[model samples]
Target chain A: MIKKRFILNFPPDSGDKPFSYHLVKDYDIRINILKAEVYPGKRGSLLLELQGKKDNIEKGVEYLNKQNIICESLDKRIHFKEEKCIDCGNCTAVCFAGSLTMNRDSWKLEFDKEKCVVCELCIPACPLHLFEIDFR
Target chain B: MQKTKTYEEINLKLKSGKAVILTAEEVAKMALECSPEDILEKVDVVTTATFGAMCSSGAIINFGHASPPIRMEKIRLNGVPCYEGLAAVDSYIGATACDPDNPSYGGAHVIQDLLEGKDVLLEAWGKGTDCYPRKHIRTKINISTINEFTLFNPRNAYQNYNVAVNSTKKMIHTYMGTLLPNLRNATYSTSGELSPLLNDPGFRTIGLGTRIFLGGTQGFVVWPGTQFNTSKPKNEYGIPVSNSATIAVMGNLKEMSPEYLQAAYYDKYGVSLFVGIGIPIPILDVEMARRVSVNNSQIETSVLDYGTEGTPKLGQVTYSELQSGTIKIGGQKIRTAPVSSLSKARKIAGELKKWLQNGDFEITKPVQMFPKNTSLKSLKETEADND
Candidate 1:
């Protein structure tokens, strides 16, 4: 079994498709929707965490592609500018997922992308504007 | 009182490269395991530092007179308006002043650009005078071309500050950083034990004319900072429980480094300068030794709610608890973060320690001491009538 996070972008006209239904019913995958935004006529996006067998997860992505839904991995979604960062720890304050932290011994800021929930709080909380979100 | 070391003796040791120096973090740990006398015997100076967004900071610059000079009445540097009340070609560019077109970049960035030897566009509008008839002048200036550039901060190196939190339903943007609504998070700014003012809580060694490390260069404390409060309540460790004891510092801006100074922008709160400051405390006696030994657990600050009309006191938390990344406030476990950079502060302390160990930097006795009693006053509103 494996757990992975992905961002699913739905084509403007493809919102009627039962993407979550097919993934859960056919692929036997567990869906945890971290964030979702649905517009009436505009394109919509879903930030989801999928937990299932490796093969099933791969099959689910194929299904998403067939439905014209763009699915991308959640990794590298957050960009931390290290050189610009003063290692001030302001980003660590609003990081509820504990993805951003200070190494107590070295007193340096460290980022673990896997643990980020894409809350986007650190983007503005940073005084130096070091944290950036790359949704594309 | 008999002294363990004097300024003269420390100077001799520093000059001879025999003086022992320790960062405040190192000394704090040493004091935990060693006696006061042992600390005094082993250490000559304890270096303290803090790097945080000091909003009340700026530079006083004298752009050398133009070939056809004018009584400069208005000026803007890199599109950011500068204070033009000074003499011709002399202006004060404040850190918070930003270009109307670009809010993110401000006066601080201009100063950093100048320090990096980058030419900045200088535009001025002058009133045509008999002796100086140029009405408008446009030019570019760098640090080398400027006759004098001084980093004159009216208030900085805060002894202690507030832990900002948002208790209301809406999120708040403040200089303390963005606060999550419903007490979701708390943010603070201070170096705690390694802070200059905290290490010398009584302003004993830190006063007017005291030599300090400002932005990777030597600076002096020119005066007690604006809003220098002394009537605040103190903890058992004698550290102020709130924002107190600030120092106004002056240094040659040309001598500063970009690595030690930075321009910071909050989401909606605007621009501020991250100032790196370090002060070395001479171990003159056992009492001073003990003061430098005060650790994070012993230093506490009030957690004030910023979502209200005025900041309402929520409670207090120690630096140890805050640094733990979470603190229990109002029975809820709220995550915490610091606006100040401990890593940068540590670097400043280490750098200052190296300067002292190499005998390149000498600690000076304050020419004058700050007053022990001073009160902070608030501006009162008055109704105006046409006379």
Candidate 2:
């Protein structure tokens, strides 16, 4: 299965429509709404992770474009260079979103991609330069 | 106090490969199953460590003389300003010293870069004397090329400290990292139970001339740090409930590494140094082992509201409460964040333990004890003309 993240921008009027529900019902795609600020009569945004067959993901994007809801695919995400990481957990101190955390038992660093907000705060906090922004 | 183990006994055990070593945190955990006497009998030494932002820390470097030599006056390293008030070629780089033109990088960063073996741009303009003719020099130097590099920190390892939070609507950056305003978040720095000063509390085993593991090397406690408050109120443990004491530490900067000595910046809070320090608390007896086994729940500190101009102390809270990642203030649940990396603290403690077992490092008894009941007073102006 192919997965992609996107920043969905909605026109003020389109905020009233249900985009995610339709994407799942019509396109047979799995939707994970990472963040959503869409409100009725407001120009808002929705961050989503869409997963499905490659053809279905493309068709879903085509549908979003036809509705004038600008959907931009995101390429930026936090990537941990495990080899360089010493499991120091310095990155966890600044990761307000709980993206990086230490395993209590093993005392090793555990990274959760979905929880990361791409704040780049961890980039400078790490002494070994183990964290990077992966554009994929 | 129960028959405390002598310092010599502990050393002998370590030398003979029969000594049992444990980190402060481990001792705290063992406290549940083992009594103080049992622990004292089994453990010879308990290693303590802390990694946190220390603003009053810096290094004094004696770069030796250049060809012919010049009386160095103005000096800067890696764009960070350095104090040239020392002798001819000696320079003191302060932890809070930031890049002269840009505020992003600071002296702490420069020191870390030096430890990383990076070539730093050293620019100095000195007065040319008859004997020392050179006037100005711009050179790239690394830690290995320097003659003498000393980590002479005036204050470090605060016994206990305040948890920082903001009372205002806007966020404020501090040496403690970002404090979300309106009690939204709190930031704390100490390694809590694993900290050196916290484990020893009363300086029974730790004092002036005490050998320590500092920045990945053996170091010493030179003196009591600035702003030390030995008069603070103590709990049943004979330790203060808030920040009380600190140590002036000295170590060879050449033997340090970037892993333990890090450069950090807290956004608008400016530059501060993250010092890695480990103190081996000798299980001198049951009393010492019991002291070392103190847990975060037993240790407490104040939570200060930093958004206010006065930075008033909000209330007293235990490290256990802070470590749980949240605390209630004014009936609202506030998220807590750690400024010090306990993971790094644990790493330092483990490293120090290996050094001791492998016979690479040894502990030293204090030549002189730290001052007890000492008072810190501010300078006052005298009335001369009126009198």
Candidate 3:
């Protein structure tokens, strides 16, 4: 009845095979492996639903840890500042979900939170230090 | 060196459940003509390093059409040459016939050999590998974000994700197998007979604990792709493609440590390695059960009956109740219902977790049910009513 969740942040270019298969076999835990969905030109997200007993789940965690699948906590504070934004469309160009769009009249920017899976792709796209990740 | 029988003979033996060991050359030749099933039936164990290829996502079933039969290649296990083509089949046989003297190689080769057939053992194993290898790659410096853009290339995407997963699995398996046993033998506290000491539940608990710690530390490698790209060469097969970024979510490890796991392992094995060893491998065979479950659940037609007035009401009831996260199962109020395909899948996942923790560890009837018939029946009934 006990349930726990952890996010595993991968470096750019890592595959899902070794982690997925090992989770199933080594820890004896079945995971709902969500397909890695990539926004048009942004980083992707791989969602996994893992469930087991308190101890087994812990064992599964240990197993993942030993394999180097570290837990990731998102910092929502990292965001783009409005005034410093250039509205050059660079962030929009790299945005996979069109989460950032250009305003019609002025060269201004707009942000959509619903479309974001928190991949943090647009943070660095802005040339100016307009974005920051809020770890809290 | 002696005059050997034709590849056909070896293929025949593989198909008939007869165990025959062959060298690498013989396996390659036989693989050209043998079916995956043929290879599986005849080989109990296969050892080869070429296994990396078979486990890859790009691997295909040649069936004699492409260069050679992909299933016929041999895979190595613990420095021994083994056939991977028959891995799934052999795993089933091995699980059923495995003795304490020979623990299921966690059905590693068999799971790969049987392809989907390996699911038979996997479902029974209750998820996860018995052993996992851990590694640490110190980076030159911590680079938060490596690239500014994402690559739309499918090949790069697939490679990136696949390699990460594969590397993680390999590391876990290696560490569990290599380090735990050595650690236990070296740190054992008993002063009695060494052979009997090996069977003590206390020792096994310690071993499982060590494996858990190793597994927990192993999780660190799943994240921080920027380090991997900058530190490792782009041409390396192990590295993920440069263009893709991975968002890895790791599970909490507070409960999965060695001390807790020691208790679980002890509960299952008792204090005697001999008794644990005596436990029947076949009936507890994870591979065979997974196969039977998947095969029986393959797509099929079905029919359902509902009274003329009750049909629509049934749909409304299911929809409403399922949305509310409750169901009337055999008059008892169940907390969840399988209203949609996705929900059904989620439900099954829940049940699988339950089975792992509470059900007998030995292979038993599948606790989850495939929705093939239920969906088909409902669809047909709805169509008839519409017509």
DockQ (Cα-based) per candidate? 0.73, 0.22, 0.02
By TM-score, the candidates rank as 1, 2, 3
Q: What TM-score did chain B of candidate 2 earn?
A: 0.95
**Model 3 C-alpha lDDT per residue in residues B166-270, reported as the tens digit of each score:** 111111111101111111100001100101111111111111111111101111112222211222112211221121221111222221122111100011121
Residue ranges of candidate 1 with Cα displaced over 4 Å: A25-28, B1-3, B384-387
Pairs clashing within candidate 1: none
TM-score, chain A only, candidate 3, equals 0.41
Largest lDDT belongs to which candidate? 1
The CA-based lDDT of model 3 is what? Answer: 0.26
Model 2 scores a C-alpha lDDT of 0.82
- Model 2 per-residue lDDT at A39: 64
- Can you write out model 2's per-residue Cα lDDT over A11-128, one digit (the tens) per residue? 8878656777888999989998776675667677767789999999899999998899888775444456786454545567667788777665455688876666556677766644
Q: What is candidate 2's lDDT per residue for B242-324, written digit by digit as tens?
A: 78899999999999877888776666567878899999999887788789989989988888898998889888788888878
Task: Tell me the deviation in Å of residue B47 in model 1.
Answer: 0.5
Over A1-136, each residue of candidate 3 has an lDDT whose tens digit, in order, gives 4534345544444444387676667666667643344443333345445666667667777766665455332223335676544233435534545556544323246776434444554554443336664321
Winner by TM-score between candidate 3 and candidate 1 = 1
Residue B212's lDDT within candidate 2 is: 93
Fnat for candidate 3 (0 to 1): 0.00
Better of 1 and 3 by DockQ: 1
Standalone chain B TM-score for every prediction: 0.97, 0.95, 0.15
Local lDDT at B270 for model 2: 75
